[model samples]
Target: MKFLGSLYRFSSSWVGTICIVLFIILFVAQAFVIPSGSMRVTLLEGDFLFVKKFSYGIPTPHIPFIEVPVAPDSDGDGHLFQGKRPQRGDIVVFRYPKDEKIHYVKRNFAVGGDEVIFDLDNFYLRPNEGDEFIEQNYDKSDIVILNGQKYVKEPYKFKGINYNPHFRNAMRASMLGNLERKSLAMRPIMVAESEKVYEYGSVKFNAFYIKVPQDEFFMIGDNRNNSGDSRYWGTVPYRLIVGKPWFTYFSIDPDKKIRWERIGRFIDTLQSDESLIYEQK
Candidate 1:
């Protein structure tokens, strides 16, 4: 009888140890399935990506259930593990500014102290003390010049049955033939002057100039028209950043047709080092 009791205790202890280890791993490094198309081409709606926790740094530990009491008037922000700093063009997963519980993924377009401007539908970045803006190409359609100046606009056509041509094209190639002819329309224009203005698609409004705070980042999705990013919410604090995606582990269509080609593919940061020369005033 004693031997059986000892065996039970040993089994219980082993199970507890295994469970603790699993929890740590899941908290630090794990995979997540994307449910929204905000990231689109870079991260598909149904793609599964692996995130390494230590990629950035050790994360601050949060009390499991109770809040720990610290010194009065103490800045007790709970980040424990220190990690590497995030750079421009990195795909980062972070907590939504509005709701800390909700997580979002976007490419880091500009870091703090970087003057980012979107004119003529082109994104330009100029670091502090930098002479000129570094122009990078996001999409061919993102470039739209109005009266010799740049602006951002959303262009859409009713070429597909679902009202979204790009999405339909991704689903079925044969559906291209079934597309009915329709008029193409351009959304409102948004220009960057003293402040940032959003005048296109679902999110349209004039927003004030945002100075990215220290250790903060500006994130945007490649799918500009569909994504709600820094232009909508705000800057993402460095401490809230989760991790950078390394590779795609799985991609499945609703039809159960797996995109074998996309699997194991690395996420590419859409950026270029080439110099852009434009006639200046």
Candidate 2:
């Protein structure tokens, strides 16, 4: 009884309070702010939210501000305890593969062994389970056939995924340039056995294809046209996955008005409530 009393006193002290806060920040939930329009309507710039760190497992806790990993990734997989992987259409927050210090949020487009086609700034997915699987799961109207294989076209449209058509020509040029630079796995090819035509001072191809490697995931932002994602840099390994957005604590637009309606709303609720989704003007 005496020992319990002493422990309770210590916990109520300032130093102990600080420790408790750090523990929560490291393993429970950490605060993050959306710094860019990469996620657009789903997550806007200046929105502050908490990230559920335990959602995908406890990644090695990093010191908060400086963003230094507190413990070495001894097993080199980046997790202290392994957990479930992110599924298709899930919005995920992860460390940028090239730079661990940077955090990026994007939707999981496809998973391991899945084939993806990028044509004219749109995405088509052929799941790893193959043709019959696509036919069984997706609506017939949404499926497109290329080279006798079925691909789901713009599968996440209901999730508010969109790209700017005005940027199509520029995006195509960028895609071809990235392919040539070999930064990502996108390779130009004529699907459905069509002939290649020349345009933009290079071979005009039907589409770019990439097969997601086992245990890796392809990520693309909801704001498709503007996001720098796996399409440009390649798939993300499970190790870099950080967590899921929990809830918006505060939001402010560029005009500096407090967005009272957004605060206290859970991420899941915001995603499913279509009326609340921002419509592009």
Candidate 3:
């Protein structure tokens, strides 16, 4: 009884409180804020959410704000305790591969061994499971034959996944420029030998293709056209994956108006509820 009382007193102390909070932030959940419209409708700018740190296992703990790793990547996999990889279609928060100091959130479009194709606007995926799995799993209308292989059109089927028809290649020049420099992982290839080249502004290119490297994931933002993602950079390796979003603790619009309806909502609820989906004007 005496020992229990002393332990309680210690826990209530300021130093103990700080330690407890740090423990939660490091291994349980960490606070994250949406800084861009890349996740749009699903996760908006100014939305403050908790990232479930252990969702994919215990990643190398970083000191918040400073973003310094608590320990070196001992295993080189970035996890102190190895965990399962993020599943296809999961919304993930990961450290940007190019700059580990930055964090990026996007949907896991395809996993290792899968193939991806991005045209001017359309996104197609060929899962590693092969054609039979594609035929059995996806709607017939969503399936398309590309170069003798079966690919699914817009396979994610999420309400927030937007393909704004009016939004043209805002990045056509830059994208084509990246292609020229071989900076982008995807390569431009004609869907067919005689297929006419598609033009955006003065830049012209056919569709792009990439095979997700082993133990890596291809990520794409829900706001398709405007997102700077795997299609522009490359697949994200397992080492950089952080965690999944937990729930929105607070949300405010650009004008600083509180989003009363969004607060306290779980990310799963926000993502799956079509009524909450923003209809592009």
Clashes of each: 10, 0, 0
| Sliding window of 10 residues with minimal summed lDDT for model 3 | 193-202
RMSD of each: 12.2, 2.1, 2.3
Pairs that collide, model 1: 56-83, 56-84, 57-83, 58-81, 60-79, 60-80, 119-150, 120-150, 120-151, 121-151
**Which ranges in model 3 have alpha carbons more than 4 Å from their true place?**
1-3, 193-196, 199-205
Model 2, clash count? Answer: 0
- Candidate number achieving the greatest TM-score relative to the actual structure: 3
Query: How high is the lDDT of residue 152 in model 1?
Result: 29
Q: Model 2 misses residue 66 by how many Å?
A: 1.7
lDDT of 3 by residue, 1-281 (tens): 99999888888999889989999999999899999888887778999999999989899999998899998886799999889999999999999988888999999999999999887678899999998999899999999877778899898877898866545567565577787777988988778633668664555558889999999999988988778899888999999999999999999988999989889999988898987776765
lDDT of 3: 0.87
lDDT of 1 by residue, 25-84 (tens): 445765667778666555667778777666787545433323231223133322455577
lDDT of each: 0.54, 0.84, 0.87
Instruction: Compute each candidate's TM-score over C-alphas.
Output: 0.59, 0.92, 0.93
Model 2 TM-score is 0.92
- Candidate 1 lDDT (Cα, whole model)? 0.54
Sort every candidate by lDDT, greatest first.
Answer: 3, 2, 1
